[model samples]
Target: MAPAARRTRPSPGPGAVGTGPAGEPVHPAEPVPFAARVVGWVLAVGGGIGALAAFVLTVEKINLIADPGYRPTCSINPILSCGSVMTTPQAEVFGFPNPLLGIAGFSVVTTIGVLVLAGARLPRWVWLGLQAGATFGVVFVHWLVYQSLYRIGALCPYCMVVWVVMIAIFWYVTLHNLHHRHLPVPGAAGRGVDALVRLHTVGLTVWFLVIVGLIGEAFWFYWRTLL
Candidate 1:
């Protein structure tokens, strides 16, 4: 036999984590195998927190209704008063408690996360559905944030938790959709999405920081008192 015929195929170098089985470098565009797990954990943890916060807010609202004089435990200060925000018409945008929606949405998110973590590969339609849900959540949270800062003139700690987790869940879900082509990938937009996907953590950190800045600016006077 010739020397070539006797030669075995090459293997990935010592640190070549991205190489395929035949030692070829995988496409940069290919999703990492571990991404499913990361998405799962994010969904599970974020959804769980959002759900718990929503449930607490629901219970607090109920108690407040039963006793108009009741002060919510989360009503820590004038600036951070859950009761004040709860009483606002904005809290029931659909003529029902906003947290009721959170309870339902976040529960589904948690269930989907558990399924993914258990090694279920969800279909594209399912991913799209999650993307739609996350988009709505992120949008709604922003509206609530705006109302809290400007109109309601108070903050709810539990609602803030929902905001944070909704941001995370939306960011990750968007990244996932882009990577898997569940969303369109065209031209410069595609490249931009690819860049975002590669540096997702940085993007997420910056996103949260912007929100923090907005919160700080909105409540700077109160925060200054503590300083």
Candidate 2:
């Protein structure tokens, strides 16, 4: 006697990671924002790097606490000094070290991304949650950027790594959610949103360029000194 074959639900497509309310993926006129694996890899790699930077920053902070005059290994020079940035009140925005938040947030991001990479069919709400987190991460990173350039007047190398990774993840995740309709598009602005979604890489490139220009302009004196 042969055992009967058991039926199983088919997995979502490689290009689409999440499911709609009816357990189906919405196919808009535009291409999928990105392949599921692409998003997974981005999230995994970005989150992992962000977490590592945050961990290093935390260790530096701890060492600094142990010795008041301790200089972080990342304190390469005057303009790029982690020690200067760590000594500022801005480093403890929530009465604790900022890297603590990074450690917690990015760890979750990495876990979810790995799950998606393993062919997990995340729900629409989960995608929405990622959208929300990415939004917050980008906003916070920008605020830190402003504080670093204008207020703090110094850049942290480890922090810069986090900034770059955070911007990329935010940009891609937002695109994914928008294209999947998890974030939804108003009837009148549907076309506009679609266009924005299609120009994803362009948007990211321009964003990075703007940041570079700002940094150069802000630190022109020290940058020229290096030459």
Candidate 3:
């Protein structure tokens, strides 16, 4: 007879891959990528900055209300004067400086961005809240742009920065929300927007270009008036 066969134990079960005796996976959780983490942090920082800027502008508006000559730092040029916009009756819609609304709205956005950056798995409702706030911000920014171009007859540089930041935040948040299906838009409207964002890169580029063109046209008109 051949030598006595030596028996060897078979490998552990399917659950044994990198697992312990409890059959649970023992590998450390994969870390988020540096690029993604950086992007999230940037969003958070941008939101915080936007919120602070809006708050300061609101405070300045308050001071101006107290003293008409209390011009803020934004009173730089005729075309870029917060004083011009603030003194307008439109700024007092609902009997308050509109920047106060921006302050409050951006504060909420900053909070959401911070929580997202911190890797908090926010609930769907929380994402929906952010979407609502961002949507409102987009609407308000457009209203301000309309006021600056048509009503106020002037554009505040600081206000323009705020508008740009608001747009960026809106785009970023909306894109994220769509990717996660957190938007409340339903049926065709929702599907259409999602398809447009997903399928038409050139369309989005053109849309952004159109916004820049409008702003440039306004600047050109103002510059020509100066000449």
Candidate 4:
């Protein structure tokens, strides 16, 4: 019989599957989705705009607080009064204008958003940090709204912009955290929040509409009194 045919094996190319020295197979990296990229870009741009707006408003509030008569460049009317809101003790929750907090908080958020938009793959800890910051902002904005409506008896247009933007940022961050499983919420709570988000886009819209309606009603009452 002829000599046994010599055995031969093909070498692996760059695209081929390969084994490590320990004989473990290496897998390829997964691609990120186009929708996620678009969302990142949107968050970056929106966060930047919100941060700039908050910074300007904070500066105006500081000036108004320091000098009561200092007229802001954007003060258009008695109803649209930054000065009225800024002068209130409620504006100084910690003996300083609340917008200062917004300026600092939003600056961090804007930086994160920009990095994400630039294709940075943030770790879980970073996402958790964003969630914590956003939760605090949302709670703080609601507190301001309560003060504006009930205690201060005045509304600030710039303040409203901050409120709305903060709400948007909070919602966006919450959604992202849930989708990426970055939140530390426990089993039942996490499932519940996720269920609410997944099942109730319309409910979220309606909830927002109700908030706007309440604000609109308050504005209508204020306008009626002025008129």
Candidate 5:
């Protein structure tokens, strides 16, 4: 009689690679797409512009404090007056100039963008931190938009640049997170999120259009005269 043969364990499949060290199901690392690289560059440039604007506004705000009759360079017309907007109480939501927040926040954004552009892959926790920061920034920008349009009755050109860059940062970061499954969603939910991100430009376009409409409508009386 022949001796009984011993059986070896089968090799793990792709699905098995999804498991964590604790044998828990996890999302595997996905390849970074080319669009992400483009967004990274955008973030770097946009963040730089935003930071510069913030720095200028901060200095201008300080100058305004020293000279009550000072005029900011960005105060071009009645409708667009950084001096008027900066003098308002809304300019300092936290007992300090809001641009201070932009200065610090945008600096971090620019640094991360530079790293990404250099082909650096951020860890999951860092991506989560970025998502949180971007979320706060977008919300804060919208609040400022409302304050500028309805309450302050003036627009700051530099501030508007910050708004545009902030939106871009938030949108692209959110899309990156979704596409990479950084958020703790189920497999099916992740697929749905991926589908939504696939048409991200559509949603982003509509979002920009909506904000633009809001701005135009908020100053409809002035806009109608230009027509």
Candidate 6:
């Protein structure tokens, strides 16, 4: 009798997402979409900008402490005054300068972004951890925004930059988790979630516009005077 012929499996394509033979049932392989890569690069650049702003603020804080008469370079005008904001108790919410937190948090964000861009697939747990961190960051930033608007009564230019980057980080991270199934949301909601993710830029734009409106309203007197 003739020997039985062996069956050779076809090679998977670059975007193939399965372990078994092409037709057999198998869980999807890691999702490495273009959106993911774009988000990663954005995170890296935004985080770096945030870190630089934070570092500058920290250095200015030190200089102020060393010489009470020193004014921060960012203290350009009444509406944009880091000196005034830094002196407020809110700036040291944990008895330490708030910029310290920014430096540490943004450094991690930037590192993660770099890793993602390098095509490293992080585990689900790591993605969850990132979600948590991003959540905390967004919450903290909102609180600081409230303080700056209604309590401290001054805005820091660098701090605003941090706010912008933080919003971007949080927005993208949330979308990534949802699209990649890292979030615990029900599978039934996947379609809706995907729709939201697709319109992410629109959502982000509205979010930012709302904040800008709030800022303008909060400092109406300054804006009115300028106009």
Per-candidate TM-scores read 0.85, 0.83, 0.73, 0.74, 0.82, 0.85
Question: What is the per-residue lDDT of model 2 for residues 92-154, given as tens digits with 9 covering 90 to 100?
Answer: 999999999999989988998899898888999888888888899899999999999999899
Model 6 alpha-carbon drift over 4 Å, by segment: 1-34
The alpha-carbon RMSD values of the candidates against the true structure, listed in the order shown, are 5.1, 9.5, 5.2, 5.9, 7.2, 5.2
Query: For model 4, where is the 10-residue window of minimal lDDT?
Result: 33-42
lDDT of 4 by residue, 1-227 (tens): 99999975545546647866665555566667333554565467656667777788878876876887899866777667777777777878897777778778877877887787787888889878888988988898888887777677667877787777787777777777776667656777877766756654565577578767867677786668777
So what's the TM-score on candidate 5?
0.82
Best by lDDT: 1
- Tens digits of lDDT, candidate 3, 1-227: 89989975555655444766655556556666322344365467767777777788888887987898787788888777888887888777778777777777777777767777787777888767777877887888888888888777887766777777787776666666665567656666776766655654455466568777876787786678777
Q: Write the per-residue lDDT of candidate 6 for residues 152-179, one digit (tens) a residue.
A: 8889999999999999999999988888
Candidate 1 residue lDDT tens string, 1-227: 54565665566555555777666855445455536888999999999999999999999999999999999999999998999999999999999999999999999999999999998989999999999999999999999999999998899999999999999999998889888888888867988887887798999999999989998999999999999
* Winner by TM-score between candidate 6 and candidate 2: 6
Question: Regarding lDDT, does 3 or 4 come out ahead?
Answer: 4
Ranking by TM-score: 1, 6, 2, 5, 4, 3
Stretches > 4 Å off in candidate 5: 1-34
For residues 94-189, could you state the per-residue lDDT of candidate 5 as single tens digits? 999999999999999999999999988889998899999999999999999999999999999999999999998898888888777787678778
lDDT of 4 at 77: 76
Query: Judged by TM-score relative to the true structure, which candidate is superior, 1 or 4?
Result: 1
Candidate closer to the true structure by lDDT (higher is better), 4 or 6 = 6
Of candidates 5 and 1, the better by lDDT = 1
Instruction: Report the C-alpha displacement of residue 203, candidate 1, in angstroms.
Output: 0.7
TM-score head-to-head 3 vs 6, winner: 6
lDDT of 6 at 222: 87
Model 4 TM-score, 2 decimals: 0.74
Candidate 4 ranges beyond 4 A from true positions: 1-35, 65-67, 184-204, 223-227
